[model samples]
Target: MNIQLLANVIGHEKGKKILINAFQNNKLSHSYILSGPKGIGKYLLAVEFSKTLLNNKSRQASPDLMVIQSTTENKKHSSININEIQELESFLRFTSANNSYRIGIVDGVEYMNYSAANALLKILEEPGNKTIIF
Candidate 1:
């Protein structure tokens, strides 16, 4: 969890800033919707965030860290569908793995279908201390 690592991965001052803030504050949103055009570090930041969660080396990474990309694998340009949101509903419905916080990084949130968006809204409506960002 060095600044160099973040710089290399995120390649931006803002990412470093956000990481520093969250890490220092000891608080990070459970859910973060990384939205942006393709190849502009949204995915990079998401990946970095996942790394942080993996080692619990930063405030962002916790035992409940989970990343939901737009597609599973071998697929490109597919938006996040309704089933993904429903799956999140189920994931959120459960308790944390280690009684720690749960984080869901829903990339490309804008691409979610109407049903998915609504489902996400419902989940957001009752965050219950779960952090959500878009």
Candidate 2:
């Protein structure tokens, strides 16, 4: 897919071009961080990339894609905990059932606590054939 054309954008043409070029050249890294101001569609971009990579019509139904988000408790800001990271680790244990690439999207990664970050770091240290977008 021509992601640069398929995905809608508002500014950040340079960043979009970089991602599209990486996809076209088969040079995407094992892990990446999409950090910027809020309401800039980072989540949407991640989902689009995941769908394109997995060739899934519905991002939620894709077996090869996992989208992780931070949790909240008592109306207060909470963090992504170690349990979530462990779940991601378990998800990574299996290969893509559809022969497509396995992808993990960690939304709002800055909300991850120290332990969770450490767990994710361990996963990144030996990413195997999986791709993670933070």
Candidate 3:
């Protein structure tokens, strides 16, 4: 499928290029890690990609296509918590609505705690067609 992720002026030029390349490739990685300096739209790229992927399927029927912010209150999702990771795992485990993709985005992964990072690693070890990270 030809997907459009318009990330211009978002500061993730390299990510935009990489995503374009991934879309062009037949073997799109099931998991990705987009890391760079802050305010570079790394998380924005992930959200855009998820939305693009959702366009191919029905967006109305699925609630699990959630954007997870791994943060505590105070408007800070700069840390990935263990509970949040567990929720992500649960979302991944469930059968998809209409049997299609359901994306989970964990923003600000650099602040992940040890427990959450370990949990994420487990998911990474077990491959799934529906998951992507940024």
Candidate 4:
């Protein structure tokens, strides 16, 4: 995929440049927080950036990327939990085929339960070489 083209579509060239430069220099922070109003492309940027970072052209087919979001079941909204967080940690342990980036994107993290928030905190405290965006 042409990342430059994608970046133009998003119209966040400055932000994208900073991220790309940091990524190229191996100086990216362990975590990132992107907060804004709905429909402002925060999620889109995360997904696209993740795909680029992981060197995967197709967003759906990227094994190096995991997106965590809220779900609804039995008419009740579900939030992130310990199991999910544990799975994320486990996913990080696996090495990429060519040592690509391992990325996790937590969407709507405000919906996480108390335990899940704590778990996420613990993960953030020790991010290893993986990249997580909240």
Candidate 5:
């Protein structure tokens, strides 16, 4: 697979190369943490990487892709909570269609509260086969 098609983001050549190498080499881990300052296209990279893993470009239409992000309710920013983590866990429990990878992308992970973080940690520790979380 061509790296350019996998992740379309400009810049972050190093990051894109790393992800493409992992995919080509079949050396993907169960979990990955993409940390950097905000507005650095981390989420975009993750989504594109997921598209490559799942062989699908339309993330919204893919059952194998799960994305968790902070929510805004009543003009207030709500941190990612344990319930969302639990939902992600449930989503990952199912078998991936076409036996492909079940990819989970958690954007704005820094907004997760303590309980939510712990829940996510549990998922990371015991991610099932063919499950990849970013």
Candidate 6:
């Protein structure tokens, strides 16, 4: 395992160890929830984990990586809608470029509306092969 990937993150030692262990053992789950208070490096940890899983230097450029976040429309309230969840489902349906894992990260999932939450749950219940969502 490459400890350097998570070297920059402050604190969260147990979380880091768990992620590394899962990667090393090939025991990663289909979904994971990193719940805690705000500004505790949850997003940073998730990004690092995604990078490690994808084995790519750039998460934004990786075809196997999909990141979903809440969108604020017209400066009103922020939300994750059903459309975003559906997009994730569609993304997972495709084959990976190199027979690798397809990783999806949903940031601020608490902002998802009821319909979106249900949609995401449906995907979680029937996640595709080699597809993981966090």
TM-score to native of every candidate shown: 0.68, 0.85, 0.75, 0.82, 0.89, 0.89
Candidate 2, 1-134: lDDT as tens digits:
64643455666667677777887888888877777886797877777767777777653578877778866543354478889888888887789888767788887777788899899899989886755544
Models sorted by TM-score, best on top: 6, 5, 2, 4, 3, 1
lDDT of 5 by residue, 6-67 (tens): 44686678888887788789898898888887788888888887877777755366889999
Give lDDT tens digits, candidate 6, residues 7-125: 87889899888888887898988888888997798988888877776777653668988889766543344488899989999999999987898988998887888898999999999
The per-prediction tally of clashing pairs is 1, 0, 1, 0, 0, 0
Estimate the overall C-alpha local distance difference test score of candidate 3. 0.67
Model 6: residues with Cα > 4 Å off, grouped in runs: 72-78
- lDDT, residue 70, candidate 1: 68
Model 4 lDDT on a 0 to 1 scale: 0.73
lDDT value, residue 100 of candidate 4 = 76
TM-score-best of 1 and 4? 4
Error of 2 at 41 (Å): 0.9
lDDT of 1 by residue, 26-130 (tens): 776555555556668876676565555444555564546555666543344347877887776677666766655555677766566678788888888777454
| Residue 102 error, candidate 3, Å | 2.4
* Ranked candidates (lDDT, high to low): 6, 5, 2, 4, 3, 1
Candidate 3 on 1-134: residue-level lDDT in tens?
43444533366777667777776675567677877676677776776666666663333534647566645544434466788888888888876675667677777676777899999889878856666554
Residue 52: error of model 2 in Å? 0.8
Off by over 4 Å in 5: 72-78
Q: Where is model 4 poorest over a 10-residue stretch in terms of lDDT?
A: 70-79
Clashing pairs for model 2 are: none
In terms of lDDT, the poorest run of 10 residues in model 5 is 70-79
- Winner on lDDT between 3 and 5 is 5
